[model samples]
Target chain A: MTLALTLDNASVLIFALTGALAASRAQLDVVGFIFFAALTAVGGGTLRDLLLDRDPVFWIADATPLAIATGAAVLVFFTAHLVESRLKWLIWLDAAALAIAVAAGVSVARSMEVGTGVVLVMGVATGTFGGLMRDVVANEVPLVLKQGELYVTAAVAGAGAALIASLLADGTIWTTVACIATTFGLRAGSLLFGWRLPVYKPRPPRA
Target chain B: MTLALTLDNASVLIFALTGALAASRAQLDVVGFIFFAALTAVGGGTLRDLLLDRDPVFWIADATPLAIATGAAVLVFFTAHLVESRLKWLIWLDAAALAIAVAAGVSVARSMEVGTGVVLVMGVATGTFGGLMRDVVANEVPLVLKQGELYVTAAVAGAGAALIASLLADGTIWTTVACIATTFGLRAGSLLFGWRLPVYKPRPPRA
Candidate 1:
């Protein structure tokens, strides 16, 4: 498989695991596990593809990623009992998935020769949308919208790094490496240290 | 505007109103009102357009619908206090929006010469996805996924009707009319009669 395809499938697998872990925490049935897992694995990329007008979608054209997502979801469903502190594992898995997703998204956009703005946006969307969808379906506030997390910022930095590297480098491998490293590094830093962005504080309503 | 555009705009307006009302109930600020409203109004159509590979999403290409949605949200934000029982109004508005959205979705797919199955899926997605997004953002279980609602089924029936009509008739007017009538009629009937589909009952977990 191509490097991009490999990165995409890896992202899908990890995201699917996170989704299934979420469903397990919510005590959702088997169907819900599968649905949420698949949704989280592909939701971001699906939105990006749609926005870019990529027909047949990446997964529809190559079902391998989807198969991996579904298979991972099922395995998580059966093996969740074996994992201790699933939430902690979920966070780490999600961070890794986010990095891979950002790399894959940036790679696709750069290859398509889309404008810089669109490429950056696609990268972030691909990295974050799936987790947002998973949280929403699980009836939790999306982590991206939560205060004091460097989630989207990390994606933006990673995507920007990818875009810059693509312009300077001869091949895409360097671009992917830069994108993944920036995203995963930022995310890991936030997880280990309490890194945060400035949050909006709502003013008290008038009497 | 053409009939399809009219239907799309109408859907956007009402869905935006419902989204704004939801934000009002959630005690969100003005920014939330606009965000939720725009998300609800265009969410479904955006997904459908993306899946169909239509470039420059309908609202993106023509800013009128987005303008209407944002305008309506702002208007509701200012005047929400004047309305009695916002939830009551929200339900009625959502039903109307669902019908219009279904019609618009079916119309687009039929015009694109897509298959009957795809047309139906797109119609349902267009009708229901906006509300789903709104509810998810509002941290409520999506009304469509809730037990016993005929929400999605209504869209399916309407889209199917449109597809059959499109095959038999010459103009899209007939297809649009059929779609709107079936969807609205079913939704209204459910409201008036408490009509519902069979609910899924989860089994108790083994000890």
Candidate 2:
């Protein structure tokens, strides 16, 4: 398999696992785990494709990702109790998946020759949307929009890096490496060191 | 403009109002209100389009619905307090919007010459997805999936009616009326008198 496809598959697996973990934490049924897992694995790419007016959507065109995601969900469902803390692991897994997904998204958009703005938007959307959907489905506030953490920023930076790298002479490999590294590194740092964006404190009600 | 377009626009307005109400209740800022409103207004149609592989997604092709949603959001942001209770009105508005959205979705799918199953699924997705996204973004369980509600059932019945009506000779008007009546009647009934599906009670953990 090509490096891009390999990374994409890995991201799908990680994302599906995170989704299943969330489902387990929510005490959802087996169907719920599979549904959420598939949703999380494909939701972002689906959105990106729809927005770009891409036909057949990624998952519908190739069912392999769907199969992989469903299998991962089943495995996670059976082994959830063995994992001491599901939510924590889910977050970490999502972080790893986000990096790879962002790179994939940026690559797709870049290949389409869309403008930089569109490419950057697609990349961030591809990375963060799955987790956002997962959190929404699992009934938690989306971590990307929360007061704590720098998740979307990481995605933005990675997407931007990819876009910039694509302009370089030796851009493809560098774009992939930069996008993944920047996103994963920032997200992992946040998990390890509690990195956060400044809270948006509303001004006191006018007297 | 076509009847479908008119109904779609009306749905967008109502859905946007509901989304803005949810944002207000969540104490989100102006940007949040607009963001959530657009997401709620377009979420369902976007999903349906992607699943059906329809080009231009709907809101993207014509910016009017988007403009309407954003305007509604801003208006709600400024005048939320005038509504007495946002959540109560939001639910009722959502019910009305859902019926119209379902009809529009069914019409689109029928025009595409897709199968009954695909049409029905698209209709339900169009009807309920906006509300689901709104609730999720507002950090509440999606009311469509929640127990003690006939939300999805209403959508299914409406979509089914539309599909059945379409098979009849000279069925366009009948299809629209049937779709609207089935969905609105059920939803309004649910609001006026507590109509709900059987709750799923889990068996206690195995010994």
Model 2 chain A: which ten-residue window has the lowest total lDDT? A198-207
Tens digit per residue, CA lDDT, model 1, A20-106: 888777665454566568779988888888777777777756667667877987788777767667888888999999999998888
Native-referenced DockQ of model 1: 0.11
What is the DockQ for all candidates, taken in turn? 0.11, 0.13
- Residues B148-172 of candidate 1 have per-residue lDDT tens digits of 5567667777888887887889584
| Tens-place lDDT digits, model 2, residues B47-151 | 888778776667656777767887998888777776555668888889998999999888878778787788899899988998887776667878876567788
> What TM-score would every model get versus the actual structure?
0.61, 0.63
Per-chain TM-score of candidate 1, chain B: 0.92
